[model samples]
Target: MVAGIQLRIGILTQREIPSESEGSEERAKVHVSINPFPSLIPSELSKMSTEKERETHVYLAKLAEQAERYEEMVESMKQVAKLDVELTVEERNLLSVGYKNVIGARRASWRIMSSIEQKEESKGNEHNVKLIKGYRQKVEDELSKICSDILTIIDKHLIPSSGSGEATVFYYKMKGDYFRYLAEFKTDQDRKEAAEQSLKGYEAASATANTELPSTHPIRLGLALNFSVFYYEIMNSPERACHLAKQAFDEAISELDTLSEESYKDSTLIMQLLRDNLTLWTSDLPEDGGEDNPKAEESSKSAEAQEH
Candidate 1:
């Protein structure tokens, strides 16, 4: 319980609050009246006076007199209602820490009271580490096959008149091999070496397209989808990351015609990869990943349920 301490921002007492219905039950008693002076003005004085400026000046003066008292009443109300609050010592110390880590905060969110082993070490021992690696590998294997098929299709369809025909040939084996690597890839060096093999083809295509063509050329579309799949499928989703994969494949199809007719003939692998995981979505986010979906399970967080 707090004693009667007068904080600067403390809540107002009832005595300070005013009731307008009971105060001064009468009209204000002042009014001003005016009349023009008679027979005292020269006719020349009226000819030189600026009419609009004089009216504006007189209007401002009247407004200033009315506004002064209105400003005072507002200031009085602010003074009565404003407060300076006092937080508990714990709260004050926490405020000193400034910001909270917001990315993963939830009821399940917790701080490490003391640490020797990691938070998940008890669960993720050698056995579980191997399991996680296996799961991760399964994702990469599917993605590699998709990457390979796209490159093969690009080679078979080698577009004419775009001057990138040579690039299609050059990148053919490189891209196809990248597709195979999602399974055999072990470390950063292996991935880097494989990517370096394809870099020359990308650079050559960039140089060729820049000469007789503008940036909006259809070649960019093929490249963009290729990279999009690489970034999202290989990197983010893996085997389970095939969301919208077919749509991306289809959207990049017209550009495929710009390559050669044979470019897409052997593209069955790409089609197969795209169709692999069309059934899942964010609607299937894992329920047992240390949290419950409030929408999916409204009764999960009840205190009574936990006590049992």
Candidate 2:
């Protein structure tokens, strides 16, 4: 899937054999916290601002990393979109719908971002690009929901022995909020690739958990590790991305099944700690949103007008 996202057709859901009695629906009724984060932190937001400011750095780093991953994802999808025109009518239609928003949204979003980046020069109210922040936030929320749904299913794999009860529910929802946040990224082949790449990176970070460190909790490691893998798929890999994803999934799923109920422990509290730190800003971007954007738009429009 990583390589395919490299081509840009990311699959939102890969094939997974589900146990009929996994209790996936019940998991939804339960709630789990998510990592404390926003799509991105204001570059100027200082950690010294408050006692809670310290953890802000880590969250920003993670969110920045995720943003970069999505930028790469956009490139991969563009590649596939370029090829879509040659596809059959039905296939082209499907492909077009998948990229419909992202294709335009990225450009629109970039306009806002680039303008904001030049904040010193653009003092005009409409020229301030931050106004678009709300739309991006909406997109992020939608993505989080998608990720939450899938993770719920995947979380069943985290429970030790699948004992029919609330513990199973907690395991499923331990990081439920993550789904919506993760899903916020580009969700096609590109997303799959992104997830796969991220998974590998996290897995590499967690190598010591299983054997070398008996005190470490493998399930927790597995969850963090697996979340990154899902990012790999966003890179636009095809179905084959699953192979790269399988290792992490296996570790997580296996840990859920084999570990005895008595053996379960909060081996690593990192996930929970991070999960509670979500500090999203539903607030507006500064006024003066991207007025300077008109010049570029006008120039492009004139060029298109001439070409037409």
Q: What is the TM-score of each candidate against the true structure?
A: 0.27, 0.22
lDDT scores in order: 0.34, 0.34
Candidate 1's TM-score reads: 0.27
Cα lDDT tens digits, model 2, 1-308, are 21211112232323233233654321212233332344536442343243233234334433533565433343333333333122222222232233333333444554455445457346655544455455556655555444443344333333333333322322332232233125325468755554544444344334433343332243444334333323322332212223333443444445555555543444223222222211111011123542211111111110000000
lDDT of 1 by residue, 150-247 (tens): 34434443222113443333233234234323322435876655555454444454355345333223333333234333423234332222334445
- List candidate 2 stretches off by more than 4 Å: 1-183, 186-204, 210-221, 228-232, 238-241, 248-258, 263-308
RMSD of 2: 28.3
Scored by TM-score, the top model is 1
Estimate the overall C-alpha local distance difference test score of candidate 1: 0.34
Q: Model 1: runs farther than 4 Å from truth?
A: 1-124, 159-189, 216-308
Report per-prediction Cα RMSD to one decimal: 28.8, 28.3
